[model samples]
Target: MLKERLYYIDSYCKTFTTRVVKESLDNMGNWNVVLENTAFYPTGGGQPHDMGLLNGIQVTNVEEIDGEIYHTVAERLDPTGEVEGVIDWGRRFDHMQQHAGQHILTAAFVELFGFPTVSFHLGKELCSIDIDVEDVSAEQLEAAESLANEIVLRNLPIETKWVTETELDQYSLRKNVAVTDEIRLVIIPEYDYNGCGGTHPSSTGQVSAIKILSTEKQKRKVRVYFACGGRVLQQLQRKNYFLAEASQQLSAPEDSVNTAITKLLETNRTLEKALDEAREALLSFEAKDLLLNKERGIVKAVFKGRTVKELQKLARLLVAEADDVIVLLVAETEDRLQFVAARGAAVEMSMKQVSASALLAINGKGGGNDAFVQGGGERTMAGEELMNKMLVSFNLDI
Candidate 1:
């Protein structure tokens, strides 16, 4: 026998008693029970399923398969007995408000600008409608929102009718009905009429309000994000909380918070630029001192806690300051060693030869061209031992 859908007859039906048709265990080891008649709306049409209780057992999920509504419960139910099912009224009502609000907003766009809604999605915290348009302007969104809320305030009756395919021509539908056998049309007087299988409230006034939060371009179309009824208030509360926290942290009033943040960012940029210039000057002075103390055309130095980038900069500065100098610099960190080798333009020997020989002693890997080479590996040997190895590659007595 076909399971009677009590939700279609009355969306407000929270509780109903029905005979248990079958009982089975799903793949996930959850118990699924089917009832002869169900008030729970199964997951369909971009709307989630209704969750509640069936015979005092928690109904975790509700889905329809092959014309059968299976209610997944926390516990098993007797296969041949009657069971009382209760719908979670709060979740059901929230879905009703959001679904109805979408119809009104979609109609408003079509009525004013001839833009049709291509698709709709009802999320947990927000709802979205994709329109068949390249872009949606702020003015257009405001106008649509205003018209939708106006319809809600008018409290127009929301009517649903079941009709045959031939009778569909009697009414002006916003879009073509997908099913021909049992077409269900949701109508708001002459304003909007569309075939939908989702649940909705009895009147538009129950939606409370409709707010368009934002919009973004999706390919060639535009997606409009919005919230209705309690969701609108919830979004507002969350935004207000963030604003309050920002105001306190910035030590500025809510109205002046943006100005304060802009000023702080500008000040930070200026400070960063000055600090970079000062560091560069210090490195230049250190390079000149190293050149003055060079021995036999080679400048060698070991640094603690210096980064590879800093070593590269210092080596470049030292070689640029002198015409006949070869610079070797090593930095020792907690567990690894880093080294850089650079030679002045007048030097004929390639730094590649030096790095190749020194890298072997440290069991490290590095790469650079002939004139300048850099690499680091394990700190198996001390910094001085690595430097001595580089000198041996040059056949220099150190």
Candidate 2:
């Protein structure tokens, strides 16, 4: 016979003595031990497996295969004697809290609205449930969350019962039970009754609290992220830490941070607009200076520590402002070279030909028409050298 899962008998049981029924090395060279009976819950029902030790050997994983629970151990142990199994209570209880909180929250959504949970996942740090709804509103989420907390405050009894498939119709199930022969129902009397095999605390108060962190649209469903029990406190601590840092950096109290941020953003926008006007004025002056230095309808210049975007903008301004002119500009960054070539509407030379010829100097790639072309590549050659190469293609002196 397979080992009786003691978790079903007592969800709070942390330690038990069970005989090692069989032991074998898995393909990964880890020992997989079967026991006569066990308290360690296997990985199922969207909850992770219990982890701790078996006979002082670390139990890293637990899985159910063919009705037999196999405990994956870190080291090989004696295949024949009685072994002491001890579960990590903190991990197990946290899972129980989260799983139970999921039940309460899911029930609340179904009760307040017609939304049903299409799927659920109990993660290590957080839990999420996908609702069979296109979207969820803040008001709906708050209402469901409030009701869940209310149930927790009431400390309602969380009852569990085993019944055959024929006996399931007596209670109103939240959804259809997955198993027919041996159905385990987790019930909060007059509140929720659902088929579940996962372990839970004896009462709703153990869940402590449920805080919905965020919601996102997934396909035709709404996936809600939430934290429960100790996770709620953990989330609060993390957010408070961030809030404190923000308050200090903004030089404002928590209450005034929002207003301060809004004002700061408005001021930043004004400063940006002024800076844009200044940049345009500077570019206009630079274009005039370059036109004076223009040689045979071609203007070439190289800049250090500038972005390709700035170089392109300057080249565009130069060609647009002057008729019968061509502009070749290069900006040297820390690790690469960027260049722009452009011709005015009156100029007949192809910017693409100039760019393609100059790109060979730096092993670069670019594409454009006769009006404008841009590219960037390795800093093998100085920006000035690259610009000179483009000038050579146009048969103009640099």
Which candidate comes out best when scored by lDDT?
A: 1
Candidate 2 on 21-74: residue-level lDDT in tens? Answer: 888998888999888889999999889999999988899999999988899999
Reference-based TM-score, model 2? 0.87
Backbone collision tally, model 2: 0
Local accuracy by lDDT, each model = 0.91, 0.90
Instruction: State, as a TM-score between 0 and 1, how close model 1 is to the true structure.
Output: 0.77
Per-residue CA lDDT of model 1 for 1-398, tens digit only, reads: 22137999899999999988888887899999888899999898878899999889999999999989999999888766678888899999999999999999999999989999999999999999999999878899999999999999999999998888999889989999788788889999989999999999999999999999999999999999999999999999999999999999999999999999999999999999999999899999999998888999999998888999999999999888896899999988778888999999999989998899978878889999988999998888778888888888899865
Off by over 4 Å in 1: 1-4, 275-398
Instruction: Name the regions of candidate 2 deviating beyond 4 angstroms.
Output: 1-3, 21-31, 65-68, 354-367, 377-397
User: Candidate 2: lDDT of 32?
Assistant: 95
